[model samples]
Target: MRCVLIISKMQEMSNVLLIIQASLMGVSLTLFFALVLSSLQKTDTTKSYEIVRWLLAFAMLLFAVHYIMQMVFGFRAQGDDVGAVINILFYSPIAYILSYSILRIGCGNNYYRKFRIMSITGTVLISCTFVGGYLYYGSMHMKGALYIMGLLYFFSIVLFIIYPMKEIRRIRKMVDEESGQEPVLFNMYMRTCTKLLWISALCIAFSIFYTPLLVIIGPFFFIALVFYIVCFLALGYNIRQMSNIIVAETEDEVNADGVEAGTVAVKVVMSEERKEMTKALIEGWIKNQGYASSEINSTLLATRLNIPKRQLVQYLREVEGKTFRIWLSDLRLEEAKRLIIEHPEYSTETVAESCGFSRSLLQVKFKEATGFTTNEWRDNHARKS
Candidate 1:
């Protein structure tokens, strides 16, 4: 009687777990689909914004499809391998989409050819490894096949992360140095990368580490957690900031027939002649102490120069090869150095005002640029009055 009772108890538990699994998938499907619609409705004003937005939508759609598949195709028992197969198919692509989006934002189309080649090669190899191993042994649930899949995915994730990071760093350094713009801060990006790493680790664990007690329950909960987290990120990450991540193009890439990148919306190219004219105008403005004005910004500068705001921004990035803030800051820094050394009698407050820097900010920027604090630099260069 005890043996029969034990069997009956186990059967009841199994049924309850299955219901939970189904409920989880159903919830996931609904949530992901709603995210898809929300992403679609959002405005994508720039090319980079458009690409990332659509990719985000597509990735969510894939998640929705994945959950649908889990519910439809034998949502697994302890011995079943259907859920594993679904994960490999959808999870890898999700990682790819995310990594690729960042790559494009950082480097533009320069790395597109190489990225495409890698995508094709990786996909083929992973597919073949998973399919061939299953066919050879006629057992989809084989540990060897799943481990191989996980290993491939793990390595591939690492490779993309490393490669994209390199390109992003390189481009950021070059563009900032040339254009006087600050480099795109990777704080948020690093957080996203951390999430991607977690996803990869989970993929590997899900493949090889399974207990009979929590078979279906594990995958269901995993799917819900990851899917919801992704939805939040996709919906929450400020899309406007993406436009701020300017990717530089080479001479060959920026020429006629080449795509213009890193603009808010304006396609009006700053021709060399116009850029020179603007430079002359700006130099004259500088001579008149235009930068010393505390309340100036790119918009005001554009208005002052009689150029469109869009054109002015392009001019700064392309011709000036620096950001407006950097350019202005450098001008002020030079004035501060001059005041501190040549006009050493000037008060710190007077110097800061003349150079358009707050006493505090002058010190901060001076430290960053010259690796010495304002007082330290002044002490080293201080003249006998």
Candidate 2:
């Protein structure tokens, strides 16, 4: 009676395991579809995202295959050859996804290259174990292989933590300096990735526990399912947010182009008869109505030029590729430059004052515009002349 009870219990466990594996296989397929959709939404500028999407797709396919093999033949125990295949298939994608997303979220190609190497190395190692399990031990070496995989997964998690910490600090510093009003997509990515890292740490802890709970590891599988579903949904949300931001920015550019078209209309109407009149009007304004650096304003320029404020602003942007202040600053800096060179008797301070900027403001603006100190600019230009 004792032996019969043990055998019956083993059969029940087998059935339960098979059912769980089947359900997970379906989840993998569903996730694969979600990943494809996410990939499709990627902007043209995100070239690295394409590679990650494809890697995820391949990993999911491998997982599906591993599951089909199990359903067709059997997965009786942890030591089964099919078990190794399933374990590797299950872990590799999650590992690769974490690594790839870390790269996508923060670092550049050098970090990405390292992640790819680790991924490929993990794949090669798992592949060797799969072949070795099937050919040699039949199913016994699978647990040892999983412990090795756990080590690899731990390695990846460490890399994920170490590599992104610097970037996270950099972004935090940038956001703090810039007052945190960054684009929404960037902000969302930061929030999602920080959550992912914490969740990943938890997943690693679970994996370490999984090695000990070899027989009754049912809860871990459920936890893993929930974790992956959450991770992918978070990723999908970020992708959609980024795509929307890019599309919105693109539309803003298009609308700006339309505004430029109207500005051109004004130019064409004026071109017919007021060509010389417009020239004289501008020259007279520049000479007499001299826009003091402190007093220059879009409204003031529009009033003096008999143009609409919006039209003046648009015209300055379209023709000069600068806002009102930038164009005005360049004009002042040019005047300062000419005065300093042409009138050696005038001190740089006097020239700056004559050019419509306070002496201190002149130094600050000049350095900002030219990436050099006032004295450096004078010396450099003197050398050039």
Among the numbered candidates, top lDDT falls to 1
* Residue pairs that clash (backbone atoms under 3 angstroms), model 2: 79-139
| Model number with the top TM-score | 1
Tell me each candidate's RMSD, in Å, in order.
9.3, 17.1
* Backbone clash count, each prediction separately: 7, 1
- TM-score of each predicted structure versus truth: 0.56, 0.48
> What are the Cα lDDT values of the candidates?
0.63, 0.57
The residue-by-residue lDDT of candidate 2 on 1-385, one tens digit each, is 9999998987787777687668767877876787777656644535555665666676666667766776776753543433544655566666566556655554433334545676678667766766665566565455566566556656655665565565555434423321211234444545565555546454543443343343345444444544544554455446422321111223244345544434443343334244454446556877873744444455555667786655555555556676666666677888877777787567767877677677777887778878987778778888998
Give me the overall lDDT of model 2: 0.57
Model 2 ranges off by over 4 Å: 37-45, 76-85, 108-110, 129-150, 160-179, 182-385
Which lDDT value does model 1 have at 159? Answer: 65
